[model samples]
Target chain A: TQLLEQSPQFLSIQEGENLTVYCNSSSVFSSLQWYRQEPGEGPVLLVTVVTGGEVKKLKRLTFQFGDARKDSSLHITAAQTGDTGLYLCAGARSGNTPLVFGKGTRLSVIA
Target chain B: EPEVTQTPSHQVTQMGQEVILRCVPISNHLYFYWYRQILGQKVEFLVSFYNNEISEKSEIFDDQFSVERPDGSNFTLKIRSTKLEDSAMYFCASRRGFGLVMNTEAFFGQGTRLTVV
Candidate 1:
């Protein structure tokens, strides 16, 4: 089975602090997506990375896909209270395949 | 913007009872999927539907689970016999089309919280 392993299952940081979460897998993926989920809500798409070694930035959040397409990372610069949520990473083996999701990193940003 | 929507934000049912979760995918989306996340666990893919039939399904989607797109827009998931362990949050997602170049990003619904007693 293809598995995505995420590190630092829980993180709590003060406002203005920076944090980085990782998602790694042994199998290569065609595309990788990042999502943020609030309590009692479904995951909302943050970004999708399709090319290897690709980097995309959204405001204070930066996402990067590994050169081998088997790993990815989400870095939040100067996190705010609004950044607190369950961050998840999911990978698709192909265009038509189902996504394999990581366990996710739950972050709490305190002001 | 258009988005996926699910009905009955929360559902509670007794063990062995049947429950049907409903979802309405984005208007133009062609690929639909069902996923479940147990409390404090990772989101797990259950099934994928396309062309009025199931395109793929995971082992977890056993005989007890079934999916249907009765109408052009509504997608549904029925759990024939719910068990105590079946309690979880179920999410429905849909994408525009399939291809390496086409946009493959999926839009998700708010999800339905199922509690099997």
Candidate 2:
């Protein structure tokens, strides 16, 4: 089975603090996606990284895929209370395959 | 914008009872999927449906779990015999097309919380 292991299962930081969460795997993926989920709700797609070593930014959130396509990282700059949620990383081996998800990192940003 | 929608935000049922979780995927989406997340657990894929047939399924999708796209727009997941371990948040997702170039982003529904007691 393909597994995506995430680090620091839980995190708590004050507002204006920066944080980085990581997702690593032994297998390579064709694409990787980042999602944020609120309690009792399904995950919301934040970004998708298809190329190795690719970096994408959305407002204060920055996402990067590793050069080997086996890992990825999410960095939050000056996080706010709204950033508090569960961040998940999902990877797809190919276009027609199902996505394998990481355990996720639960982030709590205090204001 | 179009999005996936699920019915019965929450449901509570007795053990061994049957329950059906319903979802309406985006009008233009061609691929559909079912996923479940146990409390404080990672989201796991149950099954994937395309062309009115199951394209892929995980080991977790046993005989007790089944998926159907009865109509053109609605996708349904039925749990024949629920157990205490069946309790989880079930999410339905869909994507527009397949392949590396086309949009592969899957849009997810709000999800249905199933509590089996």
Candidate 3:
């Protein structure tokens, strides 16, 4: 079974502060995706990193895939209150497999 | 923007009662999935449906759980007999045919909050 472990299960920071959440795994993935979920809502796709060592940016958020495709990271620059949410990392094994999701990092950016 | 839609945003049912959760995946998506997240927990995959049949399922998806794509767009999950522990927020997701690209990202619905009493 493939598992993605997320670090710093919870994080709270003042608005404008920077933070990074990490997702690690022992198995390789074909692609990795980051998602942000607000209370009472489903997760929204933030970005997807397909190539190893690739970086993708979405506004203030930066996502990176590991060189080995076994891990990924999400870095927030100058985070705003709106950036506060449950951040999840999901890895897709292949075309026929369902994505395996991380436990998620609960981020709170206080204004 | 295309989006996955789930009905009965919230449901409350008595134990032992059967319940069916409904979802309408994005029109052009071919892969459909059902997931559940307990309060304060991570999203867990329940089942994946393709070509009008189930392609994969998790251990959590036991005999009590069943999925069907009755039509071209609607995907449904049925829980034969609900238990107190069955309560959770259920989400429906869809993806345009899978591949190793950004387009493979699955779109999710707001979710249905199920509370089994």
Candidate 4:
């Protein structure tokens, strides 16, 4: 089975602090996605990275796909309380395959 | 925006009882899936459905678990015999394209919380 290992299982930082979470895998994936889930809710897709060495930014959030297609990262700049949630990284071997998800990083931004 | 929706936000059932979880996928989506997440664990894939049949399923989807798209828009997952281990949050997801493309992103529902007694 393909597994995605995420680092920094839990993080707590004051408002305006920056944080980065990493996701790594031994198997290559055709695509990878980042999601944020709040309590009592399903994961909401934040971004999808398809090409290696690709980088995308959404407001204060930045996502990067590794050059080898086996790793990815999410960086939040000047984080706010709203950024607090569970961040999950998921990979797909192909378009048809189901997603393999990492255990996720629980982030708390204290104001 | 259109989104996947699930019914019965929470459910509680006795062991060995049958339960059917319901989902309404986006009107234009062509692919559907079921996934489960145990408390504090990663989400695991259960099954994928397309073209009126099961396209793929994980080993966790045994004979006790079945999926059906009875009508044109509603997708359902039935657990024949629930056990204590069956307690978890079940999520339904959908995507708009065939599985051959590289960037098909799935939209997930709010999920149903199942508790077995």
Q: Rate the local accuracy (lDDT) of all candidates.
A: 0.95, 0.94, 0.92, 0.94
RMSD of 2: 1.0
lDDT of 2 by residue, B1-117 (tens): 888999999999999999999999999988999999999889999999999999999999999999999989999999999999999999999988777534688889999999999
- Which prediction has the highest DockQ against the true structure? 3
Distance from true position, residue B29, model 3, in Å? 0.7
What are the runs in model 4 whose C-alpha is more than 4 Å off? Answer: B98-103
TM-score against native, each model: 0.98, 0.98, 0.98, 0.97
Quality class of the docking in candidate 4, CAPRI style: medium
lDDT of residue B49 for candidate 4: 94
The candidates' DockQ values read: 0.80, 0.79, 0.85, 0.70
In candidate 2, which residue pairs get closer than 3 Å at backbone N, Cα or C atoms, i.e. clash? none
Which sections of candidate 3 miss by over 4 Å?
Answer: none
Q: Spell out the clash pairs found in candidate 4.
A: none
Query: What lDDT is reached at residue A74 by model 2?
Result: 99
What fraction of the reference interface contacts is present in each model, in order? 0.78, 0.76, 0.87, 0.71
Model 3 clashing residue pairs (backbone): none
State the fnat of model 4. 0.71
| iRMSD value for model 1 | 1.1
Residue A16 displacement (Å), model 3: 1.3
Candidate 1: pairs in clash = none
Regions of model 1 farther than 4 Å from truth: B100-102
Worst 10 residues of 1 chain B by lDDT: B98-107
In candidate 3, position B95 carries an lDDT of 90
